[model samples]
Target: MKSGEWDRGRFVGVELQGKTLGVIGFGKIGRHVAHMGSGLGLEILAFDPFLAPHMAEELGVELVADLGDLASRCDYLTVHVPKTEGTSALIGADVLSRAREGLRVINCARGGIVDEAALLEAIESGRVAGAALDVFEEEPPTNRELVDHPAVVVTPHLGASTREAQVNVAVSAAQLVVDYLQHGKLHSPVNAVFLEPDLRERLDPYGELGRRLGCLHAQFLEGNPKRIIVKYFGDIFDEPQSRNFVTAKVLAGFLGDRCSQPVNQVNARSLARDQGLAVEEASEGRSRYFANMIRVELTDSSGERNLGGSIRGRKGIRLVSLDNYHFDAVLEGQMVISANEDRPGMIGTIGQVLSSHEMNISSMSLGRDRSGGTALSVINLDAPEIEKLAAVAEDLMQEEGILWARCLQAD
Candidate 1:
């Protein structure tokens, strides 16, 4: 119409009815899409690691066990997962190649979920019919080829740009503020808020410790988390609210900046459970080396990671044990932890590597199981870029005697 050509043939599109719509990351938005697609007579197949099978059956949706399987079956695919390490480039070349011919992709979720390059290649190769993207790997995307493609539709990340959305967001914000002020209730808080002043005072330090430990654990985490077991040792278990509060903080920290929504102490447990993560808590009155200790064991598909911490007299919070290796390392700022063979030159080797990169070590803690065996080293660095710290860890691993190294930026 704009060109005054009136080419009716060019405007013809395929009907969505009776087509299989694959919903990846079946969270709230994905579920809504599935519901609407079902209304349109489309068969909905959802793939979410966290979603329960019964819930899918109840909604008249088939639960797909694998992403590849969903891709192979669906005529159209839409992603709705958070962009974390596991989800980044989820719909890459391999997944797209496995998808049914003429599969149309849609992404209104986060950027980087569907690999742009792969999608572009797929569209050009006729593997994918087209793509409807509301998000991109980069905002104001530089990929002009994809943007200019006649078969593709692009939006400037405006999924929540409606007038109703604007009004609802404003109302929600005002309501949250009012509720907090009048009723002392928080609906969605970015930070942890303790209602009772006395409780906050008593548990603030331990909560911080728990959060730090969680953060550290998250940095070391591999694969999808299945369960979080929090064990409280010593006098900290005396307070009735201690167990719940600290556990929440731990979950909050572990999930920091990983979830689609902001996670806080109030909603952390629920959010974890929603993602199919089982949360377990245990308490003991007896002391284990410290007056109070919060031990968290995160079990994931890869394996289990154990992290234990305690609030020392004046040290504030210290990470006491990691995977059974005992050491007193302050859980703050930029730090590098490594497992290596017990030797005289191991510490010096790490120091030399850091020195080569102009990275200064502020503090260092070393722990070993036996006189001549595997050892763990936790080194605090004077603020380096996270990327640089990761690079240093990689470099450390390449050195002699070092088995593995990991960088942690704990807040």
Candidate 2:
């Protein structure tokens, strides 16, 4: 796996919308599963007998009148209902027998949902279209029969592995329900959070911003945010000072966004509160980083997400902090800057390349390295002429025998 990659399966198609996605449990992940399903246009129907019908509607989910009906109608079935004494073989041959043909199944919630031996038989017999598993009833001693099956995609319980995913689950579970609640949007009822719409409206505009900031906090916050105090400081607050309240909301928004949950301010806070978190507020204070910063108190699930960044040149948000060190986060666009073997002017060659392409340097930052062999120069640009920029950077990295490029996608 890569820096942020986890074992979900060999990356394949994830389009889920428009299909009938039947969720067995309809719990936290199940609701999230449904939310993902809806995003891919899936018509969600959940089976959680313990929850009320109206509640399912509130989360944008439909509660099946019966489990068999859900099984019969769904094109894809994802088991979310946890394993219990009565449900040992919940997805045995009997259950699969009821499902329509070509029924794709996923079991990331827990392993016991599908009887291992039964699952293998179904897969071998072509009763299942495709299968995905993240857990096994017995962890290491997996069902070798199913493990070796190609259509039976398997992962070592990775539904809760990503740094971002774990952080969201922890924080969302800790937030105060009233501050900023989130839930399934009447499509898949799961954990429900109720909040005041006025605060929700106030918190909406900062959704993405809050999400990024919270992610930064999650990736960087040194401890578990089990008990956090969100504060709404500075000019952004109206007469209402929601320093802690808004900050907490941002954290929830961050959790909700990254996990692809149907997040809303209304439920963000409540989700935290339900998880037994101690949330507080600050009347007055100043952040050390940005002009106005929201400070978060967090505990690391593992070691901690070491993170820091700054607004670069002008509006460019560049990350400057990672782990214990701080450096300007700069990836040059076109042109050249070099950490050469300190000959006369390694910088001169880079300049020549820029001059020939008519590309101007927008901004640059250098990091400390060896006295003669290395230096890091990060440059900025005015225009992004793809061919000109890539050629220069590629040529420079190759000539220097360095791998100097990365691509990114935003959600």
Index of the highest-lDDT prediction? 1
Q: Candidate 1 overall Cα lDDT vs. reference?
A: 0.84
What does candidate 1's lDDT look like per residue over 1-411, in tens digits?
A: 887887899788899888999998776788788889988999989887555455566677887877888899999999888887668899999998898999999999889999999999999899899999999989998868888999899999999999999999999999989999999987766555444786677688988888888888777875557788999888756665778888888987887756678777678888887766788998866765888888899887678999989987844889889887999988899988999999889888999999988998898998989888999999899998766877898899899899999888878
Q: Model 1 RMSD to the real structure?
A: 4.8
Clashes of each: 0, 53
Residues 294-328, candidate 2: write the lDDT tens digits.
33344432343333333433444454533333356
Q: How many backbone clashes can be found in candidate 1?
A: 0
lDDT of each: 0.84, 0.57
Q: How do all models score by TM-score?
A: 0.76, 0.39
Q: Looking at model 1, which ten-residue stretch has the lowest summed lDDT?
A: 49-58
In model 1, which residue pairs have backbone atoms overlapping below 3 Å? Answer: none
Looking at model 2, report the run of 10 residues with the lowest lDDT sum: 402-411
